[model samples]
Target chain A: MQRIVVLAGGIGGARFLRGLKSAVPDADITVIGNTGDDIHLFGLKVCPDLDTVMYTLGGGIHEEQGWGRSDESFAVKEELAAYGVGPEWFGLGDRDFATHIVRTQMIAAGFPLSAVTEALCRRWQPGVRLLPMSDDRVETHVLIDDPDGEGRKAVHFQEYWVRLRAAAAAHAIVPVGAEQAKPAPGVLEALAEADVILFPPSNPVVSVGTILAVPGIREAVADAGVPVVGLSPIVGDAPVRGMADKVLAAVGVESTAAAVARHYGSGLLDGWLVDTVDAGRVGEVEAAGIRCRAVPLMMTDTEATARMAAEALRLAEEVRG
Target chain B: MQRIVVLAGGIGGARFLRGLKSAVPDADITVIGNTGDDIHLFGLKVCPDLDTVMYTLGGGIHEEQGWGRSDESFAVKEELAAYGVGPEWFGLGDRDFATHIVRTQMIAAGFPLSAVTEALCRRWQPGVRLLPMSDDRVETHVLIDDPDGEGRKAVHFQEYWVRLRAAAAAHAIVPVGAEQAKPAPGVLEALAEADVILFPPSNPVVSVGTILAVPGIREAVADAGVPVVGLSPIVGDAPVRGMADKVLAAVGVESTAAAVARHYGSGLLDGWLVDTVDAGRVGEVEAAGIRCRAVPLMMTDTEATARMAAEALRLAEEVRG
Candidate 1:
């Protein structure tokens, strides 16, 4: 089986994987889930990015919401609200609690998150081998004034996005403990042995960048003989989804496809995929010594996303040749 | 100000509290909650009895179901099913996840359950000071063998009742860890300072009995130099709600008002109240050397429950004299 490794963010990455699964049915796909967006909500371990991938691939995700499970109810959410517990804006459903509960329990029982994730995957069966980038806690915190009238504080990523609705300007984005976090077992091996490594159109600074922040993962991918391909999250000078531009600004990066290519550079990139809207920037990205290609990267549906995946694979093969 | 202590179970305890709040607006009401039915489900700490009380008093409880929150949905549960995670019988809603998340987080963070309960109560603000009978983990497990399967194993109180629908014949009931669990903070003090302690018509074997099983609480109530009155859960020869008969049988107690009084006995009982249907059994209960009375114990609504509370108080005064 073709061993394909994909680095992923939350919504788009998950959605793209659904398409990739269809495109390459026999491929041995492995997902290095970004834990940077993981949050401890009401004590439940909520890996938004990870869950998105799990749900999208397992065929349980809400098609419209693109984050939580389909056919979800808010009984548990209301109960928590009645209890006046937590950052309620994130909208955790009753059935979703079971996932968090099981994950948290296994984690508390000294199971590494990767193993716990495997146990969870036994149920989700997303088909792909899903591994958290690291088993250790690596929360993405944004520097912002405390919304509750307190002084400036580092808030969890979900609180900034979900609770405050990402209203404030982020001064800094820190992936806490990423410096110390070793790649989860099988992560380095997966990358090293991968036939091709692909970066989905995830937020570069927060999602993919945070995974790279973990020790050893970036180096392994760079040293691997396989072609490392990255798709631009920036399309037509803006992020396809979420507040990626705002986050990019926090890291002093411009919201442009060319800027995203420069951000990954040769340290991690051999091939870069950009949207057709920014096709003119291909020369600039290629001049930076990374092979660049323009393709229709709009994942409006499964077919579109699968084509994008196939394009990425085709580009990787060209780079290898 | 009246220092009132309430011995409570689930729905009845929470509902009675609404009226108690109305009855004595300025009084200090301390609720001693039953944690016997507490169980770990889907790796989340599910305090069904406590949640029922909290939701009821906090006004988030489903009025129709008499448990869980109203307007609840099951998206999360559906997602979990897709993941193949379960004890599929008991429903955990999305809004409900917040409670478990907060609770599990607190418990994991080294806070004992009483402090966690208090912290959770801070949000719900269920007017009354709510206290779990014990801080230690105490699970109510029922011994039963599947009529269709071989061997006997103790099932968690919830699984045996809610999931299995109480179909199996229960051989015995055990409040696991009751022998080791110390009374939660302020439980004994609350009992000692209480002007009156009234037991709502909750299950005798599982509700108040579980609280009594915790060391120091039962003794404190017995020695508290105040009237201790109880409303009988038995309406005539049967329990008003729940599978109390099954539990009673497990504990080797018959389903009778007289037997219940004897079960509580002289050490813990100062006053006993049976229903109108069991009015003739009051003499038999009083003959056991405890003050006994018969009144309408049916709590069809808040008004009926308040009246019952008043009658219990009246009986408490008689017992005190």
Candidate 2:
């Protein structure tokens, strides 16, 4: 069985994992999900990225929305607002709230995030060993010109993304606790034993970038000596979904697909897949000392996404040679 | 305005408060809700009795159920169960969950239960000033004959009442932290400044009984020298609502209006109101050195409940004279 490890973030990563699972049904997949976006809201621990992956693979995700539970109700959110408690911007539904509550309860009981994720997955049965990047808290903070026109201030990633809609120009994207955080129990081991590692078409700066920021994760992928492949979230000169361009700019990367590949760089990433539209820039990515391929990267549906996953794997095989 | 202080529990107490609010719109009503029955579930602090009062008075309560929110969804509870985390019997709906989350968040932020209750009530505007009996944690535990047939085991009061449905014979109902708990900030002051204090037709054992169990609360009401009138929860030979009889038996009190009045005694209780069906027991209760009145005590509707509240006030005046 092929051992495939994927480092992922929320929505885009979740959808990619669902497709990858379809492309390689029998592969032993282990996912190291970004916990840099993990937040405590209403005293409940909400791991948006981990939940997105679980729900997407477990058949509970809201397909249209790309995150949260399908057929969800906002009763809990409304009630919290009614109590005059808010950061009312983040849309956590009732079904989604339960996940956070259970997680929070387990964490309070002294269980680590990775353990809690595993326990939650027992119900979702997301078909892979899902691990948080680290059991330690690591929140992504985006430094932006304060909306009120003061000096720059660092806002939580969710605040910048969900609340502000990434309207403000981001100056920097910092994974707040990543420097001191160790990889969760199975993270480094998964990297060591993996046949190939894939970085899903997630936000390069905040999602995949934050996961790489964890103390030893990027080093593990680099030293593992296995083909490390990545799918571009940016297509042509823009993100297919989400505000990836805004955060990419924070890290001084252009919105172009070739820029993201170069941002991960030749040292860490062995192979990079861009879109058919960005085929012209494939040479530029290849010149950066990373093998490159341009393919249809739009994840319009499962079949389309699965084909993209297969293309990524094919590129990984080419890099191996 | 007549400054009225009420000692209360859950549904029964909440309904009575609604009636009291209607009966004396100008009265400065202060409710010292029982907190011994508070249970922490899923890492959220759930104050069932306090929520009952808030929702009922705030017009958010399920009219038929009398406890949870109206139009509530069980999505959160169902999701929790799907994750295999539950007592399964306590039916907390999504809207109700928000209340717990907000309270838990505030508590975690170092707010006392009383202050949290006050903040929550600001949203509910429950017409009355609602205060928790004590700011400190106080969980009620019921010792019951072990279902495994070995020996008596103690269960959280909610497990005994909600999960077990009170089937097991209760040996004792212990307020675990009541001995060490002081009245919440406004509790003693509410009792001291009151012109009259009322015990609504709530469970004598777990409701009114638990409030009086808090050390200084009973003394404050007694020393206030104000008329302390109580409406019996027992209608004929049984409790008007809840399994008050089972818990009363645990405490060695007979399940009768006269018996409950005598249980409070003439010192703590200056007057007691039994239902019209138990009119004959009034003389027996008065002979026990307490002023007693026979009135319609069934809270079938707000109007009927308001009449009962008015009758309790009339009895309080009679005792004062």
Candidate 3:
């Protein structure tokens, strides 16, 4: 009867789900996907975080890239390149495009993203309930001085990340419309009923942080009356993957394990897990009234990821006791 | 100053354009695309024929299939299958989905399909003006008995053809709203100013026929004052490719070279090409007041297709002389 809820970001979140599934195959796992990374390209809504989880769990994911499906092709993308559409930096393959189209179509047809995600998950049969952080639109836009245009303008996250390759420093990172977004159906219920909550080694700022930004979500998790444990996305002083260091700077957060644990703080986190490399910072994190543990968090393989998931679960139990 | 206006369908149309480019290297080619096959699936508007031309001329087309770009994948489609959302007959690739997304988005943003096609073409750089017959909606719906429900109902052309695999006999074919569809921008002008007009081996009923259905387009071609030459899609008593027989029956035209020639009529066609197999029918086509020519119309390769283009040009010149 253990109900576990996890908040997640893209690649990291998807990878963590893989581990969590392995660790608790029969547990009622509910994942709250970050929608801040969602982007519209070529008229299709692409929720990278959601798809990653779907592919990873469905066993269609590219084992190495940990993102798109295996054996991907670029014909459609090349054709699109010929069409000169979108922020081409993010490699949207032909096969991946279909998912976006279906999701986009469903969203346009008035289905909330959570329901759309569920419908998508049915085919993937990901063996867990997946919920979007919010049903309302909340895009991550970066305010930067336009190098080509007059003054500063908000550019799509993909444009800032993929197209520009995240070369330009982001002045301000805003999850557009987050203040107005409502928790998706089943999201709050999943958190309130959960015996434990785990933040997989997903981006603490953009992934789980974005979930907290949803009006009622953070409050619901804090009041869930259970252990809320987060594994640090940072190891020593760097992120596990992607340009998290660059994004962390945009929000005035240091790319350190201690800083991430402190960012979640006693407000929501009951326990925090840091990598062995950051064992020295355990006292600092624990001083914030959060129980802390040191463990290996790199998801090098399924076994390693599952080990990390097991450690998080063990910590959650200790915090509750 | 050879302004060649081509009325085209899908793969056949795109293959012919490759040859037409070689025959008249400097000819200003304007392709008026058929929108009858345009479909809305999962809310995204997909224009298959338009993509064929763009891909073929841009050198991104699948060399074997003659449609979609070469080296394509179905990851997105597979993912969509996992989600269980679609009519599921037409195979959509991930990379290809991006093009439709951009086009659909732009169209939603008030850009006409014609303009959207142009925007898409800029990326493909297909070296020709590609125009949809109309920007206003015109979907070719086939009347068939409801597969799940009782009685007769109109199903989308894609559903009838791809999903059902054209299993049921079509009771009626209607290009919905074509009567109200205005010729897309530049379609009529290209026809009126053409030095020569070519009808590639596209489906006469669903492909070229739909383009002509746009108001003022068919009349403009008939009165263009240029020699209008059409290569027969019907090589013998069958379509060179595709289910032209099924489509021909829907439009009440027999699947024969002579019948197709007469379907276009002498008022429109100056020269009609018949394959060597239909050489015996050439005299009958000529009696319809069209100067008919017998030639090897099989587009087996670029060289063979180019020769076919040269013969059509020579026939057009002979008729004028």
Candidate 4:
């Protein structure tokens, strides 16, 4: 069986995992989900990225929304608002609140995030070993011109993305605790033992970028000596979904498929897949010393997404030779 | 303004407060709600009795259930169960979870329960100034014959009342932290300034008894130089609502209106109101050096409950004379 390790973010990563699972049902997949977006809302620990992946693969995700539980109710959010407690910008529904509540309780009882994620997956049976990028708190903070005026202020990434709608120009995207964060129990081991590693079509700056920001994760994947393939979240100078361009600019990278592969660089990434529209840039990426292929990267549906996953695997095989 | 102070429990107290508010809309009512019944579930502080009062007076309480919000969804609870994390017996709904979440957040932020209650009441506008009996954690634990057999084991009052359905013989009802707990802010002040103090038809053993267990509270009311009147929860020889009889048995009190009034005694209680069905016990109670009256005590509706509150006030007047 193929040993696969995938570093993931929220919606985009979750949808990609769903397709990856379809593409290789027998593959031993281990996912290291971004924890930079993990937040404490109403005293409950909410791991948005981990939950998105779990819900998506477990068949509980809101298909159209690509996150949260299907057929969810916002009674909990409404009640919180009624109590005059807010940050009501992020949408956490009742079903989703339960996951956070359970997680918070476990963390309070001294269980690590990875262990809690494993326990939660027993219910979802998300078909792969799901681990948080770190057991330690590693929130992503975006530096932007203070919305209330004056100099730049660092806002939580979720607040910037969900609340501000990424309207403000991001000065920097910092994974606040990543420097001190150790890879959650299985993360390094998964990479070390893996036959292949893949980066899904997730936000390079905040999603996959945040995971790589963890001190040792990027180094481990680099030394693992396995074919490391990545699918471009950017297509034809734009993100397929989400405001990848805004954050890419923060990191001084242009919003192009070629620029993203180069951002990961040839030292870490062995192969890179760009969209058919960005086929013209394939040479540009390959010239940067990473093997490159042009594929239909739009995850329009599960089948299309699975095909993209297959293409990424094929590129990994080509780079292996 | 009457400047009435009331000692209260959960559902029964909340319902009575609704009536009390209706009876004297302009009265400076201060409710010192029982906190011994407070339980921490899912890492969230759940003040069942306090919430009951808030939701009841705020017009959000489930009319039929007399606790939680009307039209409340149990999606959070269901999801928690799916994760196999629960006591499962407590029926906390989605809307109710929000109250706990806000409260837990505030408490974790170092706010005392009293301050949190005050903040919550601002949203609830419970008409009356609602105060917790104590700021400190004072969970009620019931000592019961171990369900798994052998010697007596102590369980949280909720586990006994909700999970076990109060089936196991309760040996003792202990207000775990009352020995060291001070009256929450405004509790003693309310009692000191009151023209009259009332004990609504709440559980004599677990509810009213728990408030009295708080060291200075009972003394404050007794030394307040005001008429302190109480309504009997027992209609005939049974409680109007709740399993008050079971808990009363734990405290070695007979499940009778006369016994309950006698339990309060003439020292702390200057007057008592028994239901019309227990009218014969009125003379028996009066002979014990406390003013007693027979009145319709059934809180069948808000109007009926208001009448009961009015009757209790009337008895306070009679006692003062």
Candidate 5:
């Protein structure tokens, strides 16, 4: 059985994993989810990226919204607002709050993040071993224009993405605490033992980049003798979904398949998948010393996403040869 | 304006307060809510007594249930159970969760319980000043027969009341931190400056009893030189509501209006109100040096309750004379 490891973000990463599971049902998959975007709201631990993966795989993700739980009500959120307690921009449904409350309680009782995730997964049975990027706090703060003054200031990634809607120009993306943080248990082991490591079509800067920012994780992935493949979140000179272009520009990368692939570099990336429309940029990505392919990357449906996953696996086989 | 101080519990105390407020619309009421029954559930501070008073007075209390917010949904509680996390016995609705979340967050940010209660009341605008009996952690633990073995064990007050439904014979009722806790900032002042202090038809052993257990509160009320009056929770040789009879028995007091009045004693209680059904026992209470009255103590409706409150106030005036 192939041991597959994937670095995931929130919505896009979770959706890609569902397709990956459909593509290779027998594969032993381990997900090292980025926790840089984790935020404490109302004194409850909320791991948006982690929960998205769990809910998406567990069949609880809201089908239309792409995040949160299905048939969700905003009773908790509404009441919190009534009490004037909030970051009302980030909607946490009643069912979703249960996850945070449980997680927070376990954490308060002294359980580590990795152990708590495993306990939560017992109920979710997401089929994949979900592990946080690091047990340590690694908040992704973006340097954005200060509204109160002319100077630049740093805001949490969610605040910039959700509250401000990424409207402010981002100057830099910093994964604070990553420098001193150690990768969560099983992260390094999974990477070294993986037959293939895939980077799903997630935010290249804040998602995949934040995971790589963790001290030992980047080194472990690079030194692993497995093929490393990536699916581009960018297509047709723009982000396929969300404001990836805004944060991509912050890290001095253009919103294009070739640029994102080159940003990962040949040393880290063995193969790259770009959307079929970006076929013209295949030569440039290949010329940068990384194997590249143009495929139907749009995850319009589960079947389409599965085919994309199959293509990523085929590219990994080619890279291995 | 009459300066009234009341030590409140949950449903019974909250209902009595509604009548008191109605009876003396211009009175400045300072509620010293019992915090001993407060419990930490799912890592959030749950002050059942304080919230009951707040919700009941602020028009949020569920009228039929007599606690929590009206129009409440148990989505969060249901979800938490689905996640296999809880003491499912305690029913916390989504709307009520907002209050605990706000309170836990504020407490985490270093605000004392009193300050957090004040902040929460700001949103409810509960009309009267609600002060916790103590800012300190004083949990009420009841010694009960352990279901696992023949020996006895201690469980949280909520567990004894809600989970066990007070079915297990209680051996003792201990206010765990009362011996070390100081009265909250305003509690002593409220007692000292009060023209009258009223113990409503709340549980004598755990409600009004817990507030007085706090180190300075009982002493302050005794030294205040003001009229101290009480209405019996017992009626017709049983409790008016709840399992107050069980906890009353734990303290070796018979479940009768006269026994409850004698339990308060003449030094602490100047006047006592027994139900009309217990009119025969008023003479026994009067023999114990407590000025007793047989009024309609059943808080069947707001108007009836107001009349009961009026009777208690009238008795307070007579005691002063």
Candidate 6:
């Protein structure tokens, strides 16, 4: 059985994993979900990326939104607002609140994020081994011009992305606790033993990039001696979804498939998939000593996404050869 | 204005207080709610009696259930059950979860339960000064026959009352932390300045009984030189609502109005009101040196319950004479 490791973010990553699962039902997949997007809301730990993967693969995700519980209701959020407790910008539904409550309870009982994730997965049975990027806290913060003051201020990535709608001017992205954080248990081991490693078309700056920012994780992926492949979240000259373009610029990267590939660079990403619309940039990417291919990168459905996953695996085989 | 202090439990206590508020709309009311029924569920502090009072007085109480919020949905509870996390028998609605989340967050941030209750009450605006019986944890545990083994074991009051529906034979009722606990900031003061202290139709053993167990509280009420009257939870030979009889029997108290008054004794209770059905016991109760009255104790409606509260006040006046 193929051992595939994927570094995932929220919606895009979760949807891709769904496709990957359908593409290779027998493959042993491990998801190193980015915890940079995790936020403490209403005193409960809210791990957006991890939950997106869990809910999406566990058959509990809202199909249209591609995140949160399917039959979600915002009664808890509404009540919290009534109590004047907010970050009301981030909408957490009642079912989603249950996940956080259970997770927070377990963490309070001294379990690490990885163990809590494992316990949660017992109920989810998402079929893939899901692990947070690190058991230690590694919140992603974005610097923005103070909305209320003169100088720039650092805000939680969720505040920047969810609350501000990424409407602020681009500055810099910082993983607040990444320097002291260690990759969660099984993270390094999974990467070291992987037959193929894939980076889903997740936010390069905050999602996949944040996972690699963990000290040991990037080194492990580089030294794993396996074919490393990635799908560009960017198609044409902008992100396929989300405000990825606004954040990509924060890291001085353009919102283009070829530019994102080059940003990861040939040393880390051996093979990169760009949408067919960016086919013209294939040569420019290949010239940088990385194998680049142009394919239909839109994850319109599971079947379409599976075809993309199959293409990436085929590219991984070519890179290995 | 008359300063009225009430020692309260859940449902029954909350309902009676609602009527009391209606009866004396101008009275300065202070409710020292029993914290003995407070339990930590799913790592969140749950104050059943406090919430019951807040909801009931704040117009959020389910009119039919007489507890929990009106228009409550148990999405969070159902999800918790799905995660195999329980006390599933104790239902927490989504809107109700917000209160716990805010409260637990505040407690974690070093606020005492008293302060937390005050903060929660601000939202409810329950039109009374509500205080926890004590700032310290004082969980009520009931000794019961071990269902799986021979002798006996202790279960939380909620487990005994809710999960088991009080079917198990009880040996003793223990307020686990009462020995070292001190009454909350305003509790003694409320008792000290009280014009009248009325014990609503709350459980004798677990509700008002637990409040008096906190050392200084009983002494303060006795020394207040104010009328301390009570409405009997027991009407005839049984409780008006709940399994008060089961718990009443646990403490070796008879499930009779006069017996309940005798259980409280003359020194503490200045007056006791039994339902008209137990009118015959009035003479027996008054013979014990506590003024006794027979009235309709059924909380049939706000009007009916207000009448009961008014009757308790009239008896308080008679005791003063």
Chain A: TM-score in each candidate? Answer: 0.97, 0.99, 0.96, 0.99, 0.99, 0.99
Clashes of each: 22, 0, 20, 0, 0, 0
How high is the lDDT of residue B107 in model 4?
89
lDDT of 4 by residue, B3-91 (tens): 99999999988899889889998998999999998998888899999999998998888999888889978989999999888878889
Per residue, candidate 2 scores C-alpha lDDT tens digits across A1-321 of 999999999999998998899999999999999998988888888999999999999999998998999999899888888777788999999999999999999989999988999999999999999999999989999999999887999999999999999998899988998999999999999999999999999999888889999989999999999999999999979999999999888888999988998999998999999999999999999999999998999999999999999999999999999
Quantify all predictions' global Cα lDDT against the true fold. Answer: 0.85, 0.92, 0.86, 0.92, 0.94, 0.94
Give me the overall lDDT of model 4.
Answer: 0.92
Pairs of residues clashing in candidate 5: none
TM-score winner between 4 and 5, please give it: 5
How do these models rank on DockQ, best leading?
2, 4, 5, 6, 3, 1
lDDT of 4 at B274: 93
Enumerate the candidates' DockQ scores in order: 0.53, 0.92, 0.53, 0.91, 0.90, 0.89
Per-residue lDDT tens digits for candidate 3, residues B258-311, read 999999999889999999999999999999999999999999998899999999
Clashing pairs in 6: none
Number of the candidate with higher DockQ, 2 or 5: 2
Per-residue error for A303 in candidate 5, Å, reads 0.8
Error of 6 at B7 (Å): 1.0
Give me the runs in candidate 4 sitting further than 4 Å from their true place: none
DockQ metric, candidate 6:
0.89
lDDT of 1 at A320: 96
Could you tell me the TM-score of chain B in model 2?
0.99
Model 1, range B1-321, lDDT digits (tens) per residue?
A: 888899889987777777777766788999999999998876778888888888888787999888987766666666667667675788887666567767986897899888988887787778889999988989988889865689888888888888887789899888999999999989988998899988877888878889898988888988998988877787778888787888888889989887888888867778888888898998998899889888888878888877787787788889889
TM-score per candidate, chains pooled? 0.87, 0.98, 0.84, 0.98, 0.99, 0.98
